[model samples]
Target: MKIRKIAFLITFLFLWRGVMAQENSSSLAFSAYTDVYYSYFSNEMEPNALQPFTTVSPRSERFGLNVAQIGLAYDSQFVRANLILHWGDIAKATWSEEYNNVQEANLGFKLANGWWIDAGFFATHIGTESFLPKNDFLSSTAVATYNEPFYQAGAKLTYEGSDDFYTEFWVLNGYNRFLDNNNAKSIGVLFSYNFSENTSLTYTNLLGTESAEGSAVKQYRIYQNLYLNTVLTERLILIVGGDVGTQSNSKLPNMEETAIMYNALTTLRYLFTDKWSVTGRAEVFNDRHGFISGLIPTQNSGMQGLELWGLTLGIEYKPDPNSYIRGEARFLDLDDNAALFSGSYSRHKRWELMVTMGYQLDRVFGF
Candidate 1:
């Protein structure tokens, strides 16, 4: 099975290369990259240690076709269509066989009235890439966020008639469940207003989900985002955002007493020169599930504990528009004198570090 899959991928790659090599008037395109990384852990424990205890090795490498974006685009009036295929995370093994895992094809049509309609498994239209968190390079070491990443398999519409206001709505599969009838359904909405070039505000909401256990619980989220461009001249930009949400019957056990998760983050980006820039970010998470708040477990199936905070520090390097790299280090303390979420006997501390690199090529071929 592995050999057949690899052979098929190679054949597709070569055929794509030949097609791009053609001197025709088509807008099809492709690009790919590799991520090589190493990470270390402090106070890490074995898999059976307890809640928040996970295994970490000295070195691990993940490789795959990073991004293969293809589309039919025309630049004349108000008409465009894009079909993007992100060859993502082929080595995860467990999640590689998902029906929605293969390709993300988006069909978009823009109208002259500033209204657009898009249907496909496209990149999420939510706040920050954090909404569709990329954990390949920087896994969720400590803190947990309310939003999950890249919700496809639905239709989204956006309206941008005015310079100050824009709104987007999407009806999609709640999480990444693909098109399974057993999975929950979800609706996502985004609203943003730009008072000026230097300032803006935005909000996002995600709701309606049913667990595989037939739990009719729902999740809701709200975010407030602020951006200031003139903190000290036009070279510095400051971003501050907060997200709060309710997750009933979370995938995490012993913390599912209708747990609530909220996060606060602040970042400062300074452009020392036109080609070089620096960014510093600090984040904190407050997770109060059940036991940490001193609430007794309702039954043997109820939650038993709590987690207070997690921190992240990262720096990014962007030499040009086509490439960027970021390194992130984070530490999480899962101490509340609580029992293991898995009904185990022990609990441990965890720390994680990760790095990521991304590049975009506009037109990689010469016709």
Candidate 2:
């Protein structure tokens, strides 16, 4: 009861503030989205033992709330501020222990000559996939789950060289860390180019040193991402993405050896009508040194490498611009000796089906 009261109070305060800001001509905006789904796995794996990237529907045959998020933004000619709060499974995985439910909090200043600077927590500039379901063709891909940083706390400077080209540079605390875990900071840059209204490309890179809790060793990590989006025809679209990363000098026994991982994926979407669409995706991921695939080491078995290939087919129906229902079926093929999919036993293949419903409310309360 107490928790419910607190939640209600928070919601009320956010709405009240948004309304007052609008009335005062402060240029405030509010938006929210909710995603929920049900998923079933062919292997009947217990909920607690499901693999990573499956957190959205952790239970094998149950309904779940993936995420409920609210965002507030205030913008003026010279200054801007934004905040996002989230709840449910995505919040548990993406939010740090310190921040709890706060997904993003940032402030920005518009400088002269099309240059701008911003500081505080912000979404990562890398990856073709987004944390929000509405932005994705399917639920998610392994590359997005294992090889990307969800968020970063940092400052950045951006330049709009022209209408078609943009670039940004970042100085961050570290990957996904709200509080700096070590003395070393990460540096990254993003470059984007729009070829036309129908095509675009992006490239991103990050390099940093990370220290685990209670450990003195500093692990060096380097990561790169490339993404391309193109419209092939009036009804067809294509997306291509690739990622590569490496980590070295860990606390493991072989500090000299570097672990490497990479993935590539492509997706195609066809819109048959204004309210209906179909999508297909193919992907390959290689975790050679078990660094990003969450391999568990056993006394006798040691660490095992993982290679995965996946394909997905999905359909989406939009009742309106603000609501959608999607259904997807995914098939995963693993290496012969990989045991990550079927408990302690090795499995070469696994499959899952999922259905999701999502809604977005933008300024529904006149905010």
Give the lowest summed-lDDT range of ten residues in model 1: 48-57
lDDT string, candidate 2, 93-113, tens digits: 556788878889999998976
lDDT of each: 0.50, 0.79
Separately for all candidates shown, the number of backbone clashes (residues 3 or more apart, or on different chains) is 6, 0
Candidate 1, pairs of clashing residues:
132-149, 254-303, 291-304, 291-305, 292-305, 292-306
Candidate 2 residue-wise lDDT at 341: 54
- Name the lDDT value of residue 309 in candidate 1: 56
Q: Write the per-residue lDDT of candidate 1 for residues 1-367, one digit (tens) a residue.
A: 9999999999999999887666233344444433334444453345322223221212323222323333333322344445544333322321225653444566667765878877766554543323212222223222333233344577778897989898988887655445634455678788888777777777776665535535355433222223232254588777666656565554255434565656666666677776566665566555555311233232344554445455666666667865666666765545455333222322333455656565555553333
Displacement of residue 209 (Cα, Å) in model 1 is 3.3
